[model samples]
Target: MHFLQHLPHFIGLERLDASEIRLTQSVITTLCGLPALRELCLYMPSALARSEGRPFPNVHRLELLDGFPFPTTHDIVAFCNKFPNLRALASSAGYGGLLRDLTRAEESSIFPVLQEYTGTLRNLHIFARRSTLTHITLVDGFLFSRLVAELQGVAALPNITFLSLALITSESSWFDGAQIETLFTLFPNLTELQLTFMPTEPDPQILTWQINGSLDALLSLLPSTLRSISLKLDLSDYHDTRDPDLEDDFSLLFDYPHFPSLRAELMAKCPALTYILFDGYHFLFLWWKTSTSSVWEATADYYADARGPSGAT
Candidate 1:
């Protein structure tokens, strides 16, 4: 509390990360006075039940570290109202555990101009239709059937331009023709996507080869507007397979036989596609120039790009 009192001394402070600081009335009070603060990451306690109504118009991004207990309707709305210019909000895994039975009327009042969000899919509908959320990252993952059921009650989000979904499948449930169309219909403006898949069913009849068979064909069905795509696989559950990077051989999961065709197929299908990536324990990044293509070996810089402002997956 004493240290925070001195914080306002720095008139040019533009970013404040209070993830380790406890949530207190004094903390919020001090933050409200920072006119130049553009980003804030606050650690919220689960017991918080109400909000301080003051507005922070300059803050464009807010992160609720270790997301507090899903707040009540009034509490959540009031909390969001504090940041009128908040364009991006990121929450920890704890935030989206439950569904808030907010009425359409209540949903429309939240996040008036929010454009980017990173949270669970369960809570996406809360802001998707009303807000201009163009960049989204569903950190907790998603299922096609569940998403369909959820979207039935709400409207499709046509403003989404960048999307990242984590998928957990038993057999090979990653790709489907209908799913691709549904995604495009939901986010017609989508240009960048990142997909992460994890296999749950041990010793399933279908192998990685069969999955790629669908991948080769289904990828062609993706929206032509897509310019960059990233795919990551987590295979720790299969046949005592260890981390892919630690393993000497990876032929079982990533096949050398089909790489060329898959790459070529994607390049030709999406004429505007500029970047393609296969990231996991092993990684490969490819980019297309005017008439030629180049490969980027795995590097720390590539990982940063995947999570940077322009690309979030």
Candidate 2:
């Protein structure tokens, strides 16, 4: 074990098809020997539903799977502790839920344990389901309120630097708007952000979100040092949902007056902001098609010059 220790910094345990408890044991053995390991990605099998607490102690980069089989609050908390020094985390689990659950849990809950290692954490990337719930719609106001409060409570992590959130269709509107607001308010040190929304129309229900909040809320929440923003919006409401092969129609949302709030806000609020990219291929196509010829010509010339050899040709 000692001879093979320094082989590499990343250790991936995937598709072993082992049970949760047994897999946990094997993982502990594999990771304990590699004290210097910094990156770890665990792809659990369908049957393996759980793992013991603190699977690793020094991992600086961690990625854990979610979806398919929903990850419970305990599973996430335990995983966080496994990497005490993790500065970057990209997970497929319910990241917002993990944060929310950690907050709502009692003082004796796993959040305190996570707090113990918060100093080493920096970038967090979450990919989970998104809901269409509105701010004014509340099932239990106190529950969500506490979740936000807890997020704000830890928003000031001294070492955190970047955050990326991908909200799927399963989550309510709360994740994109309110949850995002709470996150930015707390973590002012963030320098980069990537927010992606994937709206799906599954069987049994055909729900769509109509966001009433101003895009200003999104811009206002970002830190002053933020430098870039990337949005992937799937606005298919205006299209025929009945058509199985219907392509996403994002034009309606892109033209919304509030859509440019971020750009305007960045220009006004964050002087450090310099780069922006909008993905939503169809939307871009339409934008290019509708733009003035002068503007297009200028952009083409600028790119040509930027990539030309020694300013020639």
Candidate 3:
């Protein structure tokens, strides 16, 4: 009476119906013996059944969870040796360790064998302990930059049309203009870009002058092949005025110049920019006349009836 031998008695009866059956090695041995099982998954090591010199040949889509004790890369390599046709692998481990465990000899080895992978590689998610690190380490630390390099390193496959970067505003210095330029260069076919970041209230006067400049710089970094862009900035910080730098930040967030520059830049370079969502406001209809660009048009048209000083409106 071994532990795995008693599994089938505890199997599905009138009371037991669950799609995802999570079990350890002892339980799996019993579950696999059930001919009624359709799609089986082993969260434990693939080698568990093999240790007994038996194989569960029916389980089509296998997922290896993080419960295995394989510390080195070879353990993963040995595991994948059994499940040769595994289609997708999803893991929360570091990319460097994952890649080593994956046992991919080269770029082709990975894409061809795995076919479609949805997780970051082992080395892509590394971070520096301290604030002061060199450019190479900084570049390595950012996942998107590493992704760009990996995509470039790999041989031809289907073109990647869109790339989304999960950005932290605190990490903005890591993604300077040079890094952005390198990204566009690496992924020439990329047309859509999504950037998510925590917001900072730019200086009203400074933003009045620099917003468009920054927009222009960003636009210039992108390739001509790009047609659409979606940029998101988290404004939760914009509402907070406690910091010394952001003492008067609320004023900057609502400042007239900020919107004007944003409007002008959107009108100019992103002409094909079919869509734009700013803050929480959705600009569904944008009517920019080609006859003459008037900055005061919105001010006059909207505030014409208001009782205020002539210049106030």
lDDT of 1 by residue, 197-264 (tens): 76564332353554565475557567778888887766656524544333334534444324556768
How high is the lDDT of residue 221 in model 2? Answer: 68
Ranking according to TM-score, highest score first: 1, 3, 2
TM-score of each: 0.80, 0.46, 0.49
Q: C-alpha displacement of 132 in model 2, angstroms?
A: 31
lDDT score of residue 196 within candidate 3 = 48
Candidate 1, pairs of clashing residues:
none
lDDT of 2: 0.41
User: Which one wins by lDDT: 1 or 3?
Assistant: 1
Candidate 3 residue pairs in backbone clash: 95-121, 95-122, 95-123, 96-122, 96-123
Q: In model 2, which runs have C-alpha deviations exceeding 4 angstroms?
A: 1-30, 45-55, 66-83, 94-161, 166-189, 197-223, 236-265, 285-313
List ranges where model 1 is wrong by over 4 Å.
45-53, 93-99, 153-156, 202-205, 237-257, 280-285, 288-313
Error of 2 at 47 (Å): 11
| Residue 288 alpha-carbon offset, candidate 1, angstroms | 6.5
lDDT of 1 at 248: 36
RMSD each, Å: 5.7, 10.9, 11.5
Give the winner by lDDT: 1
